[model samples]
Each structure stands twice: as C-alpha cells, then as structure tokens.
Target: MASVEKVGNIEPMPKIYPIGGGKGGVGKSFVAASLGALLARHGRTVALIDLDLGASNLHTFLGMPAPKDGLNRFLNKHAQTLDSTAAPTPVTNLFLISSSTCSMEIANLFYAQKIKLINAIKKLPFDYVLIDLGAGTNFNTLDFFLTSNKGVFVCTPEPTSIENTFRFIKAVYLRKIKQLIKRHDFDAQAKAAVLDTASNALTSRDIMDIVATYDPEKERFFKACIGRFQFKLILNQFRKNADAGLGKKIETVCNRHFYSPFEFLGGVAFDERVIDSIYAKKLYVKNYPATASTMELEQIAELLANGQPASSLLQPAL
Candidate 1:
C-alpha cells in the first residue's frame, strides 16, 4: 500500500479522466475500479474517486469497506481536502476516495461548494485521477463529468441506456458551449437568449446563425472548441456477435447528430466472473486474472494509457 506522502507530487498537473454514463447499473463503478487497478498494476499511482456522492460504491467494488471519511465530509467542511478523506485500499499504487453516505443535502450542494470540491480533487497527488461520476445529468454530475481532461461515457447495448447516454453527452457538450459563450463577455440576458435558442436542439448551422449576428470570431472559436473536446464510448455487457455493432452505431449517432465523433474505446463481454467477483467483494482483474473479461479490460486500459487508436480493436464480434 502506497501512502499519500510516498506518492510524490504530480508535477505539470496529471491528467484527470472521468468515467460517466447517463443511467445507473451499467457497470460504471466496476469499470472505474478495474481500470484503476490495471493502471496501478503498471506502477502508476492512481486515485479512484467515487463522485457519485449519494450512491458511491467504488470502494465496495474494490472489496473494501466504506471509509469513515468521504466527499461529503469534505464538502461539509468536516475535512480540509479530498486527500484528507483518501483511504488506502488493498491494491498497490492505488488510493480510494469513497463517496459519503446518501444525503439529501449532498444533492443540494451550492455552486461554491461544488467548486471547492473540484479544486480539492485537482490538488490530490496521483499520476491519474479517475472519477467515477454519479449517474444522471444533474448539475453535480454534469459539472464534474465535464471538468476532466478526458471523459469516458459507458453504456450497455440496451436501448434506454443508449438513449440516455446520448442525452448525457449532448448535455455536457451544450453546457460547455454555453459556458464558453458566457465567458466571452456575453451578459446574463444575452447568454440566456443564446442558450434558449440552443436549448431547442439547435444545429451547428443554427449556432452559426446566432453567433454570426453577434461575433463571428467567437462563433469560429466555439466551433473549434466543439471539435477539440474529447469523448470516448465504451459498450459493456456485450454477449452476442451482433451486440458489437452497437458501439459503431453509437459512434455514428454521436457524429451525425451531435457533430462530434466519439472514439469507440472498446467493449466488455458479459462475464459471470465479473458478477461473482463483485459479490465476493473482489476485483475481477485480481481475482480472475485469466478470464476473458480481464483480458478485455487490460486492452481498454492500454488504449486509455497510450492514447492508441481503438479502431483496430473494434472488430466484429465472434
């Protein structure tokens, strides 16, 4: 177990990656733990944060009991920084930040409180900060989801989950666009006017129309920002040959509708050992090392670490 002190400072600001899905029970927590574990196995210090404030279970997935301190304590000023709530898990080179117990108040954290929490997350010492965001598109989840250097959206082959995942992605994109516009000297009334139009499911052309009327340079900048934002998709619980096509379909949908091409990261087939390990309070990567699921997880981890193109791995299912 590596202590926080032993983990030297992450100079130059480590990259933060957030894993989020629009709906719950799609194995977001499981992916977070497995990826963190794999990264740790490679000698990189990893911090797994359960940002699902009310329903965090990353600790459970890692086979550890919930910590006495968590994000809630930090938010309520019961702890100074998120590092103060960090607990050493059984995995080497990995640290855990559990979510506080369910709290109605957590759902109502003010904007200032949320900013404080994010700043604390940035200050944590680690090479990689993987945030397992809470499910849904509420202000809390969306804010943290978009704050990372990269965002991974996990969804299964189910229709409802895919639709909600699309919604979540669109919401984040629109929110970022709105923020950029406001930051460009657009006052509250003007900003609300632009957002109202964009809220009606406006197209890129529509955005150009509104922005061209005000500042064409800002519009160009907005388009460039949209192009630069990074989003990756992972299809989980795949079981059949046809199930693999769902990933490309999602990518196509995102590119066609949202004007943003999504990198189809990879897929994980349905493996019984994943569930068995969860029930046993152990990570499959450690407990079922040779399983197919573990192999696929390793491939995904490599893709994330090296920024390798996943197109080669996106083969048709057998």
Candidate 2:
C-alpha cells in the first residue's frame, strides 16, 4: 500500500506521515521530532519536513540551530529540489527540512506553488518522511495533512483541543473525499453535489448519498477508496487525572462517524522535563530516554514502522 514515484527511474515510496492538529500548543512538533528520532534510532533513514510555515520552530525542539537551507530555498527556486534542502540532524539517520528561514508570507502559497511543493515532497527519498504541519483548517494545512493517508493527529485531553482536532479531521476528510471525486472523474452532477452550498455543509454520508444517487456502482468504489485511509490519533500532554481511555474513546467515535478507520496510538504523558529539554535546546527523547513519554513515543514509533493496516489509494502517483 506504499506510494511509488518515478524520478528518472522508479523510486520506492517513503512512508510519508504528516503530523497535524487544528490548534497549536498540542505538541505536534515535539511528536514529529520524537517519532523521527525514534525511527532513525531503529535504522530507518527519516526526513522530517517542518511545514509550520510562519511559526516554524521544529529546529528548536531537535536541539539544532536552524538549517541555512530549507523549504524557503526550494519554494523560492533557489534550490533545485526539496531533497537538496534536507539538513543532517544530530541523530544518525534523521534529516530535517526546516521552514524557520521562510519569509513571513510563506504560509500563503499560491495554488500552483502548493501543488508543486506537494509533488516534490512525494519524490523525497527516505525510508520515512514525517511532515510537521502548522495548526489551522486552512487549505494549505488540510492539503499538507492529506499528502499521505497515514496522517497522525495530535491533541491534548482538553475540550478546546479535542474539539479543534475533530474539526481538523472533518476538514481533511472532506477535502480528501472531494479529491477522490475529482481524481476518479465522478460525473458532473456528482461533482456539483459536493460544491459548497451556503446553507448545508457536506458530510461524508452526504457525499456518499450523492454518489449513490448518481451511480450506485461508483458508491461501492468510493467507499472502498475512503476505507483505505488509515488515520492515527495521539493524545499529547496526557495526565494521570485525565481519562486514561480518552484517546481510545475518540478513536472509536471517529471510526464510527467517518468512513476511514482511526487508530489510537497511545499517549505521551505530560512531563516538566520536556520543557526543561526544550529550554536547553536538547532532544527530549535523547536526554530523558527512560521517561514515560519517551517509552510511549517509542511504542507509537514502533507501531508506525511495523503496522500494515492501510494506505490511501488516491494519493497522486508522483
């Protein structure tokens, strides 16, 4: 279920996972950095692309000064390819494509430019590619999260964070359904049905009903395609007092509501030492390898590397 690209010759598909949540301060960057380091420690060459745009700070979490070259160079055409901007990290097999040096307006990418960048990302050569996306339901953020079927959403165990995360999920899921409709070349009426009508926002069931109304045969195809998306959820900043099963409950609810399956990939406990490591510019997992957060992250990393649940059938063949 891996995606393949042909750049000069056939290239293996790196398992691309875009980490995102609707709201900031949920530890998305930290999760990306930790997962990349853990995967690299286990011998996978990983590329961590910070797509946090204007507020990029993944470099700080990784304990490295911002790399001189990054997405800015690639987007500005100063660099030939996205791969050229990958800077080595302290970890042996991990690389980072920092967005810290990008201009203030970097987040507002033109549609064509956004597509070009997404295509370039698909062609990146690595065993795994983890994208740290900015927080929002903007087109850029949603599109980046859809870059791969294996998107990991992070959220704290709070009402606002969880609510925003759900919004993020719905936005991405809707965008993906629309993409599938376009990619599969659904009929004119089917396409028009999904178009926003001021009063009613389209839901997954609504889209499926429209497809079924247009072509019952295509409905099956559409459901099958949607089912292939395997999204994973992570509860960040978890505490002993919070519901221990909140992540699992959310996963069950999401799986029940959405067409795609959701997997609860455990939680990373809140630890003050994490802040200490960040202030000191050190990788938390490396500095506190025995902490509960580190252990849970390792488990999540292992699942990501070894699990074979599903992958998107609609991701453009780069």
Candidate 3:
C-alpha cells in the first residue's frame, strides 16, 4: 500500500466525480468500485469514498476488512482528516474511505455537518475522487452529487428505476436553480414578478431565461453551471439487446425534459459471476475479468475516462 505522499505531487487538482442512483439495488457501488479500480490500474491515484453513509458496503465490495474508523469519526472531529480513515484496498493505486458505522439515518447529518463533510472531500489528495452516493434524492445526497465536477447516474432497465432516475435528475436541476435564485435574493416579490412575465411554470428553462433577461451579467455563469452539470446514465442488469435500448430512451426523455444532454454510459449484462463474486466478498473485475459483465464495466471505465460517447461503444456493429 502506497502512502498518500507516495502519490507524487498530486496530478493537477483531480476532477471530482460522484456516482449516484435515485433508487437502491441499481448497482451504484459496484460500478463505482470497478471504475475506480480501472482508473487506478491506468496509473491514476483514485480515492473511492463510500458516501452511502448508513448502508455503506463499498468496503465489502473492495474486499477490505471493515474499518475501525470512517467518515463518522471525521465528521465528529474524532479523526483529523479524511485521509486518516482511508484504507488500502487490494487494487493498486486505489484507496477506500469507509463510511461511519453509525445508523443509516439521513437526518442524522445537520447542515454544518454536511458542509464539513463536503469540505473534507474537496481536500482529499487523489487524482480522481469517486463518491458512491447513497440512494435517494434527499437534500444531503443531491447536494453532494451537485458538488462534484461530474455526476454519473446509474439505473437498471426496469420501469421503476427509470422513473425514479428521472425524478432524481429533475430534483437536482430544480435544486440548482433554487440555489442560484436564493444567491441573488430573488425573494417572493421578485419571483412573482418573474413568474408574471413567463407563461410556463418555474422550470429550468424559464429560470435561465429570466436570469438572462434581468440578470444579464449572470447569464454566462448560469450557462457555465448547466454546462458543468455533466450526467452519465448506465443501464445495468440487462438481459438482452432490447433491454439496452432503455438507456437511450432515458437519455431522450432527460434531454427533452431537462434540456441537458446526458451521456449514455454502457450497460452491464446480467451475469451470475457478479453474484458469485459478491458472495465471495471480491471485486468482480479482479475475480472474473474475462466475464461479459466485467468487460462491460471496463468499457464503462474507458468511456468515462476518455469522454467517449456511449452510443459509439454500445451500438451493434454493422
């Protein structure tokens, strides 16, 4: 295990990447671990943070023994920094920051605690800090997800997962707009004035238009905000080619509704090896690299790292 100092001069303020899925049982942590391992294998120092808080299982997925310390300790100032809780995993260049052993209560975190945790994550020394966000659209999860430079949303082909994923995406955008509005002290009076001028309800597009019209100077800032809000969608547990199309469908819906172009990350097929690897408490990539599921995950890592379009790799070859 290499010490954090051994990472050599920290590669230019690594990009913050957050992995989140609206609903549970969507394989968010599994994909996060695989992506981190792949990045580390390519010589990038990666910090995999299990932000799942209450139900954190990233340590088990990475094959690391349960930690004696974690985020909870740091949040309480019992630990000095996030690095203190960082544990070395079996994968080279990959480290795990386990979640606190505390109960899985989302409301357990106060506003100050939330800000402190986010600040600590921003200070971690790594080339890529991948946060495995807990399931749901609660303020805590949404705030952390938005704080990252890139946000990846994972979903299965099932309708329930897709519906919840849409809700999550919409909630994030709406929250962002509200934050921006509050920053300018756009109180009830100002909001009423803006609403009277617009025909539609308070949507992201309407917010942008209002900002551009009245707050012209901040238009560029809002545009940059929308541009920086990158999203990548993945369809997991796919059983057939038809199932893969679900990703594109979701992407279209997101683009139409949110006015955001969501990248379609590749899908993972239903593989029994994944289940077996989990049962054995091992990473699927290291345990069964040759399996179809593992290969698909590798492709996802490659696409994300290179910023390649999902359709180019996911489409059937003519």
In terms of TM-score, which candidate is strongest?
2
Off by over 4 Å in 2: 1-12, 196-200, 308-318
Model 2 CA lDDT for position 184: 65
Candidate 3 lDDT, tens digit per residue, 1-318?
A: 112112234533666789887999988998899889988887988999888877888977887777776777787788898877788889989988887575467445887777777767777888889999988888888878976647899888888988888778877886676665555555454456455535435656667776666667776766666665668888888887555567787788776766556888778888877778788999888988766787788778877677763564465345
Q: What are the clash counts of all predictions, listed in order?
A: 0, 0, 1
Ranking by lDDT: 2, 1, 3
How does model 1 score by TM-score? Answer: 0.85
Model 2: residue 264 alpha-carbon error in angstroms = 1.0
Better of 2 and 3 by lDDT: 2
Q: State the local distance difference test value for candidate 1.
A: 0.77
Give the clashing pairs for model 3: 54-104
User: lDDT tens digits, residues 251-317, model 2?
Assistant: 9999998889999988899999999999999999999997889888888888898873123312223
Winner on lDDT between 1 and 3 is 1
**Predicted structure 2: lDDT:** 0.86
Consecutive 10-residue window with the lowest summed lDDT within model 1: 1-10
